[model samples]
Target: MHSDVPILLINLDRSKQRLQSATEQLNQWRLPFTRISAVDGKSLDENTVKRVFDEDNARCRYPYDLTIGEIGCYLSHVKCWQYIVDHKLDFAVILEDDLCLNADTPKVLDQLRKITTEWDYIKLASPYKFRPYHIVEQLTQSNPTISLVRYRQKIPSGTVAQVISYRGAQRLLQQRPPFFRPIDVDIQWQHELTLDTFGLLPYIADNADAPSEIQQLATRKALKQRRWVKLKELLRFKLKI
Candidate 1:
């Protein structure tokens, strides 16, 4: 693993427009990243409807066959895992294509690295939703985890840029369950179960209607419904923890 971390951008070949926009943004910001397309291994030309159904069915089998969403999540995790094994990198950052970073990203990342060194369970650095009452001003070690600064309002849940430690990456690869619904939520739940999940204040902004099916679905659901869902998830996660 190289000491220098490379940002992995998950994308699909069909989303040429969004991909191009993301590429342009990265160039404009001069951020280094590796782009990988998430295509169904069975057939690249599969129709959009079929791809959607396959993804909904979660028909992501091994030996190359993969659903659309599975392809994205799998490739993202695989690339990170392979990088860790090959280069022995301590950690790396991962992001979807729909978000942009703030000007202080480099400095924030530096702080993230320092926090990771002090905590084993610091799996992700979420740059979205600045919630109140979740702040951990300085690096203070909790019994099982290290706490970081959090915002004072409720943070909206979704994919943003995140930095993952080597241990976190290994945990992801090792803890594959039978069903992986909402891959982001699954990983977040896993972190919650371990009580090692940390949030970063002041999100990097998730572009509206930016080519994300999951986000669209979540948007359609009522805010109250979303809150209830989160509450239920928390209860379920508490049992696991």
Candidate 2:
């Protein structure tokens, strides 16, 4: 049953090539999926923007103003979460369009279906390098190679691929909207989202490393770095006193 789990593929309307790549990969695995027309930050309607995004909150909470591309990407994931709730699905696999599937993915996904661990969210792909994590449960009695784990120190980032339960979807949606952080960052702040999150080891998908469709200007990058500098200076001053 991995095939039983619904897969939601987030693809922008203009990213036909990415859509094609994802479709081919899923077809190869014989895993069916539904395509979500991603929210395009380039041309957001005023009303929809007002309804979904909170600029003031984002500016206050996040280090820098979010690029429209980041906002659109976050909204795209939100669409998948909403789908899980509306359909009353028990669980769903959400995949971005730019992931390369591993041959072991299907087998790992099937084992995940049989595991007994109580989980709200599980990451299938992590952007960060390996960090300390404790194994939570062995996926199968026979194969000791794959297991579920909880991060001990640093939480991994990226929304490349993940599994979300119906309860998880509900908790995420419960956020009193006008969401502030990027989707990945918001998920990492489980203290706020309040979900029992975990990661599947070893990762079953990798980024395709294509030129990102989400565009951020140089100014935005510099602004984020500048915030870190200020924080570092504050830390230094505290150390002196």
Clashes of each: 13, 0
TM-score to true structure, per model: 0.62, 0.87
lDDT of 2: 0.78
Query: Pick by TM-score: which candidate is best?
Result: 2
What are the per-model C-alpha RMSD values against the true structure?
Answer: 7.9, 4.0
Per-residue lDDT value at 113 in model 2: 75
Give a tens-digit lDDT track for model 1, residues 69-110.
553454445555556556666766666666665554444444
Question: By lDDT, who's the top model here?
Answer: 2
* Residue pairs in collision within model 2: none
Report residue 196 deviation for candidate 2 (angstroms). 0.7
Give the residue spans of candidate 2 off by over 4 A: 141-144, 214-241
Q: Cα lDDT for residue 195, model 2?
A: 86
Whole-model lDDT values for every prediction: 0.49, 0.78
